[model samples]
Structures are given as C-alpha cells and as structure tokens.
Target: MNQTLHAIAPEKGRKNKSTQDDVVYAHIFDAILEQRLAPGTKLNEESLGEIFGVSRTIIRRALSRLGHEQVVVLRPNRGAVVASPTIEEARQIVFARRIVEKAVTELVIDNAEDSQIDKLNQLVLEEQECFSRGDRGAGIRLSGEFHLQMAEMADNPPLLSFQRSLVSQCSLIIAQFESGAKSHCSYDEHFELIDAIKKRDKSKAVRLMMHHLDHVEKKLSLDDDNASDDLKAVFSNVRGKK
Candidate 1:
C-alpha cells in the first residue's frame, strides 16, 4: 500500500460517543472508494486503531459495520478485509442503482427547490474542477456524492439511505473492475441530467439518468481474469500508518 494510506486521521474537533468509530469507518470507506485500499486488503484492527488514534474496540466496531454493509468481509480468526464483490454482485448493484436513481431524478424534478438545484450544480462544478486538475480520486468521490445529493433532494430518506449503500458498493466495483483509465461518470452526462431536472422534464431526466448509468456500467471489465486480484501495487502508496 502507498504511504498516503497511513494518513487516515480523525478530523480535529470535539469528540462524541461513537464519533471515533464513524471517523474510522469513513476513512476506510473513502480509501476503498478512492482505490487507495484494494479489495481483499487485510484490515488489521490494531493497525487501524493506531492509525486513527482509536482503540481496537472502535476499529472492530467500524469493521463490523462495514461487514454488515457487505463492503468488507469479516472472517473467523482472520479479522476483516475489504470486500471482493463477485461479478454477479456488481451487475446487481448497477441494476439497483438504475432503478433507484431513475426514481430519484424524477422525484427531484417534481420536488426540488431552486436552491437544491443550485447546490447540485455547484457540486458538479467542483467535480469538473477536480477532473480538470487531474485529481481522479477527488473527482470520483465527488461524482458519487452528486448522486447521493440528488437522492437527498428527492426528499425520500429511505431511498436516500439505499442509494448511499448502492453508490458505495458501486465505488468498490469500479475500483475493482473498471476498464482502461477512463473516468467513471461523464461530467457532460451529469450536466445534461441536471439540465433536464432543472427544466422539470421528467421523461428526459429519467431517460438521461438510465443512460448515464448504462454508460458507467459499460466501463467495467468484469470478465478480466485479473479483476479478482488484490491490486495492492496500484495503491502501493497506501500504508495503514498514522
């Protein structure tokens, strides 16, 4: 792993009960999404506790939560590691995302306020800036957040929660099976979807969202033989150090 992987630290501020666990979980989850932590990389509890300035108990809690979400695997006596999703799981995730996101885009068209639309546009702008700066990891994270933000704007908490999980899983799948060196989400497609929503063109928004997801799915090399390997070399800079 890269040395930067050791840079998982809690934010500087007040601490509350279980906040440490949340911080640790977010760090690991973000690392996975950013491809800094490869699938099947062993998540040593003691090492993580040291890295995040937390206790082993807290690390265990965080790992357990990730396991529950199927983002990591917890093995008997083997501790935890990042989840290596199968090709079937990957397909299912993309399918679920299309269903949920189509609903979300339609709902946003129906219910979004001007301010919410503005906020989404701002996020896309920031995402474009990240891409322009060659910050692929930041761009990828921001791209996923854009979808989550849209789900929030849909004003359906249950669906929003589901989208969050699905998006996170998609991040892992992309990291594992993405083909070539292309970006995951197209900025132009996102812009078009936002425009459709802004115009309250429900049919267009739904159509654009589905097509956008299809484009994303088509970028994965799910059949690659080496796709199952733990790509530690790709993220060799990530060291679970403090």
Candidate 2:
C-alpha cells in the first residue's frame, strides 16, 4: 500500500485526546478506502496503541467511530477488526448506494455551482492519472471520492454523511468479493456524468449514475470469499519504525 503512517509521536506535545483520535481514525479509514487494510484484517487495540503511541482508550475511540460507520466491527472481548460484509449485505449496500447516489445526481444538477463542477473535473483528471501510473489502489479510492464529491455538491449534509458510510462499506465489499478481473469505476463515465450535470440533464445524469453503479455491482463476485487476518503483517509497512 502506498499509504504511509505519519508519525504520531506520543511525545510531540500532543496532549489533545480528540486530535489523536482523529489522526488514528483518518489513517485507518484511508487505509480501508485504499484497500490497504483488507477485509477481516485484525485491528488489535494493543497493537494499534503501540503503533500510534496512544492508549488503548484512544484507539478504542477511533475504532468506535469506524464501527459506527460499519467499516470496522468491534467485539466485546475479541477486539476490533476491519469489517467483512456478507454477500447478502454487499448486495443491499450496493443497492442502497445506487438509490442515494441517484438522488445525489439530481440534487447536484439542481444545486451545484459551475465552480463545483470544475472541481469534479479536476478530480476525474487526477483519478485517470493515478490509473495510468499503475496506482490502482489510489485510483479506486479516488473513484469513490468522485461519488462523495457529488454528495458534497448536492448540498445535503445528511446525504453526504450517509454516502460516506455506504462508500466505505462498498469498498470492503469490493475488496472481499471482487472478481480477479476487477471492473473499477471508469473515469470516462465520470467525465460523462460531469457533462450531463453541466448541461443540467437530470435524467441523463441520474441514468448514468445508476448505470455506473450497476457496472460496479456486476463486477463483484458475491459467491467467493477472500481476506487477510494478520494484523502484524497487514500493518507492518503501515506502522512507524521504533
């Protein structure tokens, strides 16, 4: 994984508990979105505390936030780990994404400013560049970011927050059950959606959004199961050196 663990030195005068919690949450959250922390990978609180130089309480706070988003699961005595959605759960999540994003598309057309559309175009260009350089992990994460950007442009806080959770859950689903020949979100389709929004073509934009989601869901191999469970191995490169 290209995502690196930034130094969260315990002695850096960082006495703010909330700040530490946010840093840990952002790192693990980005790792999951980038597929660095694969589904079923254990996120041991003690190990994470040692890695980030924080107490288990802080790690638990971060993990609790992730668990609330359904991207991480916390067990009573077993500790926390990245979530692995079941096949049925995967289907429902994808279906829910399509619904929410379709609404997001319509909202964008109605509410988005020209500047917002321009920003989205820039994001697509960056996403395409990532793919061209063989950075599929970053590309996939940017692909999901495109969808979230749409939610942001929609000017609906509730929808944006909900989409955040759904997008992460879908990432876990894709990581666990995607076919070998993965069908990533196409940058071209993203450009087309942008065009439709520019023209205020609500129906076309909504159609494209749903169709894009259809392609994503079709690429998943729901019957298969795959994951990594070793916290040490998974986070070896991710953890800062002592």
Candidate 3:
C-alpha cells in the first residue's frame, strides 16, 4: 500500500446514495491502482459483469465513467481495455502530479496546526507498521495518501477534492508505467517530507516532494516495452518467494 488514497473507500455499511454502477467503478478503479489489472488488459463485458454480479449495462456504465477519467479506453471494434497510457501521457501525469502536490505541500506548511501534524505522525507510524509486516498493499495505499492527507492539512475543501482526483489518476499511471509497484519512498522519505512540513520548513518539503516525483518518473521503464502483461508479471514478483 505504498499509496493509500483508495483504501478509504465508501464506508462498508453506508449506502450513501451511490448506485451499483458507481460501486463497480470504484472497485475496478481500485483494482487498477493495486495493479490487479495491468494496463492494456482486455476487459470483456460479460466477464466483468459476471465478476461484479452486474449486467452488461451496468458494466458499460462503469467502463464509460472510467474512460472519461482516462483510466480505461474504449475503441471502435476493440471494445474496452485498461488504459495503456503512452510515455507522453506518462510525462504529463508526472507533470500534473508535481503541480498538484507541490501546491498542497506549500499549503500544508502555511496552514500547519498541531492536530494535523499529530495525525500525520500517527499515519506514519501505521505506515511503519505496514513496512515491518511486509504489507506492500498498505505501503502503496499510504504513499498516495501522504499527499492527500497533506491536502487536508491545508484545509481547502475544493483543492483537496481536486488533489484527491489527481492522486487517483496518478495511481493509475504508476500502476501501468512503472516496472515495479515498489514506490519511491521505500526508505520512508514520506516521513522526512512530513517532518519538514511539521517543522514549517516549506521550502525543504517542496524540494523533497519534487525530487521524489522525479525519482519515481525515472524508475519507469518507458522504453520499448509495449507488453504490459509480461512486465506486470515481473512487477508482481517484487516480494514473492519462488
């Protein structure tokens, strides 16, 4: 769980007015984030409908929404598949990530409060626990969340919402583009980023985050590797024992 934005899914027992299509949308979207569905993977309507216990209509609706979000692609005669973003698109994703998160990091420090810093510390502790237990899922989820929680630190509701979307989309890109699910902060760089924030060292935090994103971009194997499925098998071996 290197990035954790999707972990805070809609409450388990609370319907909250969302439709079944929306539920499938979230589930599949999270699956992409978790790299359970590699980019460019075929998504058959009947198979998805069966898996999700929904009709083709509902699956279509969900796929349509994901298409709008740039997470899934629908082509003429090709139907639907997980979006295999190009290197150009990957660069744009990194650019968008830097702009959105840098702004939030600045805001986090400017509007710093004792409680938010305290919460960040608590989050980091839980992050460490996940690390010790070798729970990559938690690390992945928490990595993304480190930025979203920073948005909360800023106390800007609208910007927070937008940042949340940006991070969600970023997760999809990382899932596809990066050769491995292992994130840039495996050494707890996020802890240092937030520590700088808590100390009100705005400049340092911004620089750290920028460097982190750049490192992440560099880790991407965006060369002649067009076969996502085989590459995903390589990534899935990150911690698996033979």
Best by TM-score: 2
lDDT, ranked from best to worst? 2, 1, 3
Instruction: List residue ranges in candidate 2 displaced over 4 A.
Output: 1-18, 34-38, 180-185, 222-227
lDDT (Cα atoms) of all candidates against the true structure: 0.74, 0.76, 0.69
In the predicted model 1, the residue pairs found to clash are: 1-236, 1-238, 2-236, 2-237, 2-238, 2-239, 3-237, 6-241
Candidate numbers, best TM-score first, in rank order? 2, 1, 3
Query: Model 3, 1-242: lDDT tens per residue?
Result: 21322443322343355677776776677667666676788878876666667789998988887777677888878788888777777788888879878888888888978888887777777767766677655655566666767887788887777776666666676665676544345337778887898788989999998988888777666543433443234234331321
- lDDT comparing candidate 2 with the true structure: 0.76
**lDDT (Cα, tens digit) per residue for candidate 2, span 12-87:** 2443443778778867876675566767777988888888788999999889978877889998888887887877
For model 1, how does the per-residue alpha-carbon lDDT over 1-242 read when each residue is reduced to its tens digit? 12112112122242233366776776677677666675788888777765666789998988987776578999999989889887777888999998899889888998999999998898788778877877766676677778888988999988887887787788678766777644435678899988998899999999998998888787877643342223334323444544
Clashes of each: 8, 0, 16
Model 1: lDDT to the true structure: 0.74
Clashing pairs in 2: none
The TM-score values for the models, in the order shown, are 0.81, 0.84, 0.75
**Model 2, residue 238: C-alpha shift (Å):** 3.5
TM for candidate 3 is: 0.75
Off by over 4 Å in 1: 1-18, 182-185, 222-242
